[model samples]
Target: MTIMQEITTDSDQRQPIITLQGITRSFGPVQALRGISLALKPGRALALVGESGCGKTSCARIIARMDRPSTGDLYFRGRQFTSSQSSEDEKTYRRAVQMVFQDPFAALNPVFTVAHHLARPMLLHGHAKTRSEVAARVAALLASVDLEGQSTAGKFPHELSGGQRQRVNIARALAVEPDVLVADEPTSMLDVSIRLGILELLSEIKRQRNLALLYITHDIATAAHVAEEMIVMFAGQMIEWGDTRTIIAEARHPYTRLLLSAVPDPDRPFVPGESVEFLRHAEAIRKVSRDASAAIEQIGPNHFTRSVTL
Candidate 1:
């Protein structure tokens, strides 16, 4: 089957809320993304995993309309949106797609209280027409993220812990009633202990709201926590993609295996000599996987891997 056919088949009965078809972006001579294609459906998430500079943010920016793709089309519910849209349409689109930025501290205004942060979006989006309604909605938003509506709503970004600040950011995103959520490494900056809590919150929100989520992270292991499917990108190309469990358990591509191997293994004791060998293997995989190739091979029922030009 062709790429479009595969998308259709995988989508099953549910239509994709957002679809990226053959998307590509370039800067001068450098191509940041190469013919990337994926779909995000309501109530489900697809994780974009790779090391830094693997074009993960570029894809997220395109989906969030923060940046435009140089080539290929972007669609919302089968309607092409790559071309310029009217003011009203643009406003609607922007409101539907909300982004939770990586940095909790930088995502919010230092001076604004958490209540203000959540209230502003509801007011601007017309979700709350009255001051009282805005206040109520802000309280509910804070509560959704497990924050105390009374105490937490009055605190500023600096007054909260990193995890709390991130929750506030998430609450801000939720305040808009977005159909899609692009969480770009939402927990990478937080302490390791708090990462799982944020991931769990995202999962809960996605199910409760039936929101399509695009989770971008360099840590492949965390993808399993928040996403139903996974796409492993390398050097601006999707090297492997499929069901998250299948991809994690039976990763076919060398690059995908390299990423899994990098995940800390608690059962295996660390050895001094093994570190050098691991580094050598990782370098070898990177060298080969960086080469561009268009050939795609189906490895399983839903899994696919791209060939690397030698």
Candidate 2:
């Protein structure tokens, strides 16, 4: 099948800046995304957490227009179009939404200065005027990402630390003044100590600029750190999702609990005479979660868990 045939539908909504309905992708035999659906509202973030190959990056690429789904409804802003969009339309859609990938180190070229990277996006999207205008805008972008324009704009990506490079990536995404930001494993590549700094920057952007953000990661702990709402994915399907606090406190699905249980505890809990019997049960739960046909059931306000049979 061609690219357009891969993604099923185009159903936009007026309320959401971006929406995905029944999004499912298959690599011939392997289903990458199993009818995944989520909406990104302006000024809020939804954390998509899952193990690698659990469809987080696939979802990111689909939303970024870099990849397409096998069968699903995609919406921009209250409009409906055929899944097979013209090249021009695709370009337009990409300009409205942008992505920050996991490896900030690899996302940029070693030779290009920070100015060159940020300036290109601004010029490509017509966010800047002449070279001088591009310079000014690039500086502003650097500042927005909490980097020093004077020092950063002149430095190459390699000269910057992982945190700084990620900042530059975020700034480059904002260079186009996009409504949606898709961050896939954004902080996983950075030093653990600096991860919070990057998360804080994203939060500040959402609050100040009213940008909708999608934070895709495997780290559930950090999901609560950045996103107000969360969706936990396993085996290419959502297992548990709801308010960040609610999902954390009232986890129902075996996968969700297992994930939470896997979180390294500084003060590890001791089980009373239960020498990991729950672990065998946990492995069984994972095996069951590997199936993609589980139904979804709402357990609380905006909280949902996968209904796995057998």
Candidate 3:
């Protein structure tokens, strides 16, 4: 079965806020994405999981309109907008779809306060017309992200912790009242202890705002925390995808298993002689999983895995 067939959910009956159909991107001789298709519906998140250079960020950039697809159709609420979009329409589209970048510190300006960052978007998007309204909306936005409105508003980015800065980033994205939120490794740069809090905040915000979220991450374990549906990509192609808990419980793809097995376990100590053996095994899996002509198979009600040609 193809990925499209397996990804058919009852939620799809409701028109997706953002849809990527056969999206492919390339730069010169290098192809970053290949026949990628997915839908993002309100109040649901689809996690894109893969190692570095597997085109996860490329997919996010395409969806966020930061980069255009080399070949594909991008649809917003069932209307095709990939090829032609007027200036006003484009601006509207951008406002409706917001992005939370990976680097927390880099996303915020050191010179700006939290209130300034939030208020600017609200004023620019016409969410707030008056100075008082912008200030009130800024306070509300910070509160929505669990930041203390009074204390956080007056502080600059450098004054906050990594996790706190990420919260502000999310609040900035929400200021525009976007229907879709694309978070690219939002927790990767934070301390390990606070990652779960950030993930929980994202899940809560999704439910509260009814926002379609595309969570891009390399960590398979973390995907289960923030996403309902999961897509496992390898070499620019989706190798497996399904319900997060289901796929994690019974992963069919060799590549998926390799990723899950790689998760750190304090109980399992590393052996001195295991490094070379593990590297060889991982290399073998990569070689087979990289085959372009792999056939997809539906392995469960919502689960699908690709057959690696060996």
Candidate 4:
């Protein structure tokens, strides 16, 4: 689907809610991200697509304040707030921007009951006071995630299904009333059928709360379900980005085309080996796409590409 500008109003087009300008990251000799630019509009989801180790996770980490960008300007609500952030500022940022990690099972504490898990964030962020208020809010949080209040409150992480644990993670992220939500490979660990439920819940929460979202995943096919805009990254650099519909319909970047070609088609059953072949070739594409290039070609409205020259 296309970016719903009609639904999300830009604040006089002065700035995006979250903006990363020329982001770059390096780990010793390895370059994790390369001059990447992205934005998260309020009340809309922006999907960052790439293969494993393509820097999608690194980008998510930077946005969540878990890691600092080696070179880039991160602007929150039009103000520059990079790694130099003060302790108080960092605390506020943590409350404003929350993250939902990939492994649902590992995210929550097995020893803690659901109530304790939910209470900590609400208490830490000063969202609720008194044990009575905390208990009340925990129940509400569980309900927000579509879990039955009474039953889910006492269950531990191990007691719930993969999908249930993920829902709790989402609820915890929401407990702080954050402005930006970053989810990294959130549905990859869930059953295929259950993934859609989580995606729908996220969409519902976004609309209801008007929270800007950064949805990071390797599955390009799933981007259309949650994100209105899209960015296709190859070897840590963004090669193509624009409206989701445009990218899926008219993918220009060779890497982007390679990704879409591998997605399963509903009209016909795909041969088992086809996707495997595409995945096997992914590394070859990244090896060549990693070359830092100064040139960028605008293919269409909100569509651009940085094709590697042979």
Task: Provide the overall lDDT of each model, using Cα atoms, as 2-decimal numbers.
Answer: 0.86, 0.81, 0.87, 0.82
TM-score between model 2 and native = 0.90
Reference-based lDDT, residue 119, model 2 = 88
lDDT of 1 by residue, 122-241 (tens): 888889988888888888888899999999988888999999999999999999899999999999999999999999999999999999999999998899888888889988888888
Order the candidate numbers by TM-score, best to worst: 1, 3, 2, 4
**lDDT for predicted candidate 4 compared with the true structure:** 0.82
Distance from true position, residue 178, model 2, in Å?
A: 0.4
Q: Judge candidate 2 at residue 305 and give its lDDT.
A: 76
- Residue 132, candidate 1: C-alpha displacement in angstroms: 1.5
- Clashing residue pairs in candidate 2 are 6-69, 13-78
Best by lDDT: 3
Steric clash pairs (candidate 4): none
Model 1 RMSD in angstroms: 2.7
Per-residue accuracy of model 4 over 57-176 as CA lDDT, tens digit each: 899888988899999888878789876778888898889999999999999988999888888989998999998898888898899889998999999999999999999999999988
Compute the lDDT for candidate 3: 0.87
* lDDT at 84, model 1: 79
TM-score of 1: 0.94
Residue 260 accuracy (lDDT) in model 1:
79
RMSD (Å) of each candidate, 1 decimal: 2.7, 5.0, 3.0, 4.4
Off by over 4 Å in 4: 1-14, 266-288, 308-310
lDDT leaderboard ranking: 3, 1, 4, 2
1 against 2, candidate with superior lDDT = 1
Cα deviation at 217, candidate 1, in Å, is 0.7
